[model samples]
Target: MLSTTNPFTLKNIADYQYFSKEKIETAIQKSSDAFEKWSEISVSERLNFIKSLINTLTKNKQLLAETAVAEMGKPLKQALAELHKCKLLCEFYLQNSDFFLTGRKINTDGCESYTKYEPLGVVLGIMPWNFPYWQVFRFVIPTIIAGNTVLLKHSSNVAGCSILLEKLFTEAGFPENVYQNLLIPGSDVKKVIENKTVKAISLTGSEKAGASAASAAANQIKKAVLELGGSNALIVLNDADLEKTIPEAVIARFQNTGQSCIAAKRFLVQRGVYDTFMEGFTAQVAALKSGDPMNENTYIGPMARVDLAEEVEKQVNDSVAMGAKIVLGGKRNNAFYEPTILTNVTPDMPVFSQEVFGPAVPVIPFDTFEEAVALSNQSDFGLGVSIFTSDIEAIKEKVHRFQEGAVFINALVKSDPALPFGGIKRSGYGRELSMEGIHEFVNVKTVYIK
Candidate 1:
């Protein structure tokens, strides 16, 4: 038996295995070897196989959802909902892959021109634990349908779920390395990237990690697509429907306990309606329930880990000391953060620029329309933003004016496999869903034949 020293200073909530250098190499080699056979299959065939994978997920929904909740402390109900969303992404891609990946014919000048989508062989996908299954499924189904095999480097905290993912894919008839999980520490991720077999990389993580991966990918001249953190603002203008906007705003902020990448992190209310909006928002927040994820009554679960909870608590304390006010729920018990709401956040506070990535939200009021747009564009991260208004003119103006990847109006912004999802600035680049995702790791070939 080989004795191993675990590299992580803290044991992950799930005790995920840290793969050795040799193991990563082996997985990469397997994926490379498997790609030939997998890619040889027709796109329609691959889509059918992925549809079967969704069916498997449906049959095993409870077991998988329970595992995710056990590993990361996500609400059981929400976790079940996550499973359903995963299925949606699966079927969405299955139904639409043919449409997105179909050869495109264009009338360029007087010549006949058609563009074909080709697979990039092998793709290395790095995922986070917050939405363990959804994130991977969101990336995997699309890539596989595009004729690419996947090598998942899921967050160590969700290692067990990682195992289930591979099993599900294999049982669904994925070839040897068509979709494989590498139970590895991220410290050695560069080695996997450096491999000749890894044609490209995809990531959904913090800004720091995305930068590191981008550098690694650039060094090797391989393609990389990233969806980093976000401090997405939920802007509510004066003329907006106050009743509808108020409840949606609170749910937008605290959904996933506000840990979501597209979660409304900054509340930029036009000062004209700020006072009235805050009154309703704060009351709904105060009435929130916080406790065990398994308890159906609990509206807020623990923050995934004790250290993460502490980090969130520190951000709240530091910001409040610097003059921010907590209107509701700022306490922490172990890994559980109270569903917190703060006001008077300045741009300088770490909480404002950096994604809180927890169960807390910061509300900043702006006086004018220009100021609202300016404040919304005031972050390094620009993944998604929500706009609440009945004004068609304002919506048109902001969509043209806002500096984020996706803009949501009258709805919470989220990733749908049918739509392209990614970010800009520090939020990283490249689109993740739709035909955009399929082509991200593929050689978009333009054949010019006389």
Candidate 2:
């Protein structure tokens, strides 16, 4: 059995019967069978089903939001926002998928030559607990519209949300076997990946999990898209408007209780503005209220699980021991961890070097832009980075120096349906959302005519 314990209440909320190997096999076979038919449907027809998905999401937004809150401790408001984002994504693909998937004519020696986008078969998605609905839908929507079927093996901690997602797809009028949730443990993921019916894989989770999934997919010679961990940095220059940047930085780090992969984990501020940014940032973080995820007023919630809270605590304690000062909120209770801020943090500290995966932001002072860029690029995970400065020319010159998948200027780094999202180095590879995402599982075939 797979059971989900509410991090906020520290109580068992739901239990799902695990999928046997035979059932997993059946899902794979059915998805593979469905893909043959699904891939043949016109893009306009697929858009109709996607439209139904958007309507279903809008209709059941509250229910979906509450389920995410109970299962994974995301604030109800943020949960609802995630569902809305998913809806927007559905609409995004509906408006642009045809243009994205349209064949392009190329100049060639042949009489007529063009490149066509054709769907691969079934794709296996290994999703995580954080942003459960968004992560799954972000990958599933594009894959399906590109004419591929999907089998989800969601995190064990969010089993109820996973089951709810399967139901959502069905209610959206998606054909049978088009989107199936596999209620299986992580150990069984390899078996599903090794299944010949699955043509590709996409994962959103930890660095270790991403490495393992990539290795498994590589062994099968299957295409894989991995959106892994991030220790993203928010660089604040001396000229940056603290009034505007500080609040955005706080949200970037502490929203969703700082459980996002793209959340700003490291704050690299210029020495001249270090103290000013620290005062405002710390005060903003201190004012964040941690309470019941279902509470409408709560801005911060429990860390997703007891073990996850403990991990964040260990990182903070270890960093403090390494001469880092806890500016505010370093306490932990059960699964609830306080929104923490640390100062005098050096590169050697775990809080500076590792992905904290919680509401803990470390403020590291830097003397120069070179130092700030170096500090931001020091992490092994390079998912995204944010730079705050008024000089557009200076930003253009220094933006490429920060090695990350996405860079936000005077704003928080975020994923958008219009932009391709993914990272380089240890942050994992391939893109999600936009045209790049839909093409990830499609075969770009070159056709030559005599």
Candidate 3:
């Protein structure tokens, strides 16, 4: 049985649901009971549930987008983008699950043999707030379509958004306890993870949180996947088109108001074009419009919370004190942090090494492609890196040698339903947005007969 606890938070918001020890235990128990029947239903039926959920989401994407923006401070455009991605993921899986999850036949020595894909049973998703709605659905829809039930323990800050999702599933005719959301506290997570019935775990959070959760799951010898935050770097070669690359750097660093795990934080530019790149990039950063996220014109919003914005502010200022030069911005008022750009940033600076989870960017100069690659891979976290160069050979070499989970050539960092999303080192290990993702929480069994 799963041990549960109460939800602990600074305050409560309406439309959120909290699960008690008894409640979560009951839900898991119910899920375990339902799995007997739920797992037996044809994969087609399971997918129908997902389709219904998608249809329901499409009908109310506006309200859901607004709720997430209110709860987590994501710009409304990005929030709606998250909703659209979630819907797209659902439809993609609905059309492709059988191909990804179906049993595959193997060539045997004159005998028949095949590999079977089986559910992991009672999978728990411990997700984050930056992209609340999409994060949960990115893991949930695929797991459900694979015949696995989901138990979501979302970030406390986005509890309101999480509950709305649960209600949507309920309204979509998902049976009780199927794809359930638990608005519980941090203390409760360990208990649920330890439960013998819960077969595996997936988390998207901080390095500290991922380490703790990975340790807990490891101690029990259970399967777990972690998608921790990243300090991804973007590299520009000396041969790159400065005009084309500089503007791309602005969007790459400032996307999501610069709160994404995979957002480009460090810009490694070859010294030949470094000054020109910084001139254009810094201008773009300084001119960004920051205000209420609900305002359509606002590209920059509050940093999800005032404390987070303050921490980022401190990190940028400390970098400046450590010999980093603030080329564009380094100010904060209330929750609004002006998009910041720092040049003369060395690897030793904190902003260069740490995950600056706001509208802050640091630019470093390198002399050669080798130095640029070295700078990009020096960090302990290897989530993603973007290279802006017109040299096809250099792009190939960087893509082959860059130690990140994903490498983008002449483009910014991104996540797509078609590609596997994960990281190595402290960025955490687990694919979340592709077929590889659907397999993360499942068991591959070898069914052989003598």
Candidate 4:
């Protein structure tokens, strides 16, 4: 049985019976069978179904948001925002999917030459707990709209949200077996991946998990897309406007209790303005209120689980031991970790070198713009980087020097429906959103007719 415990109260919220091997096989087979029909339907009809999904998401926004909070301790407001994003994602596809999927006419020597995007068979998505609803929907909406069926093996901690998603898809009038929620153990994931019916796999989690999943898919000779861990950096230059930069920096680091893959994990400040930035940034982090996620007044909520909190505590303690200084909050009470900032952080410190998936931000000082870019690029993770500066042109010139998937100038990094979201190096491979994302699981067939 899979049990879900409320991270806040440490109480068992619910227990779900895991799907047996037989059930898993049956579900994959059903999805494969459904894909045969689903993929044959016209794009316009599929988009009409997406319209229903948008309506369903809007109708059940409150219930879905509450379920996310109860299941994983996300702030209630953020949870609602997640649901809204899901609706908008569906609408985005509804507006652009036809154009995205349409075959482009190519001018070639042959009488007729073009490329067609065809759907791959059933694609399995192994999603993580952080931003559970958004992560799953981000994968599900596009995969389905691209004419592929999806089978979700969601994080065991957010099992309730998984069930709600399956229900939502059904209520949206999707055909039976087109989308499924598999309640299976982690060990069972490999078996599902190896199944002949599952054509591709997508995962969003730790680097370890991404490696394992990618290996399994490779062994089976199937395609895979991974969106993994990130130790992103928020670099503040001397010319940056502290008033505008400080608040965004704080939100980039501490939002969702800092459990996001793309959240700014390291703060790199130029030596000329490091002190001033720290003064304002530390105060903003200190002012955040840590309490029940359901409370409207709460700015910081508990980490999704106790172990996650403990991990952050250990990272902070080890960094402090290795010569880092704690400038602000660094206390942990049960599952709640105070929004923390560590100053005097060097390249060797755990908070700077590793992916800290909690509410801790380490600020490291650098002397030059070159040094700032170097520090930001010095990570196994190339998920994202944000540079705060008044000179947009200067930043743009140096942007290509930073090794990350996306770079934001004078702004925080985030995922949007119109852009592709993914990372490089240890942050995992392949794209998640946008036109490139829809094409990931599709067969791009080139045809030449004389």
Q: For candidate 2, lDDT tens digit of each residue in 1-450?
A: 878898988889977799888998898999999988999999899889988888888998898899899988999999999998998898899899999999999988889999999998999999999999999989999899999999999999989888889999999898999999999999999888998889999999988888898899999999999999799999899999999998999899999999999999998899999888888888887788779889899999998998999999999999899899988999999999999888888999999888999999898888988888888889899899999998968798777887999989988999999999999999999999999999999999999998
Count of clashing pairs, candidate 3 = 0
In model 1, the runs with Cα more than 4 Å from the true position are 1-17, 106-113
Worst ten in a row by lDDT for model 1:
1-10
Pairs clashing within candidate 4? none
Q: Rate the local accuracy (lDDT) of all candidates.
A: 0.83, 0.91, 0.83, 0.91
Give all TM-scores, in the order shown.
0.94, 0.99, 0.94, 0.99
- Give the distance in Å from residue 388's predicted Cα in candidate 2 to where it truly belongs: 0.5
Please write out the lDDT profile of model 1 over residues 288-321, one tens digit for every residue: 8877677787677777767888898999999989
Q: Per-prediction RMSD in angstroms?
A: 3.0, 0.8, 3.5, 0.8
Cα deviation of 18, candidate 2, in Å: 0.6
Candidate 3, run of 10 with poorest lDDT: 1-10
Model 4 lDDT, residue 121, Cα? 87
Candidate 3 or 4, higher TM-score? 4
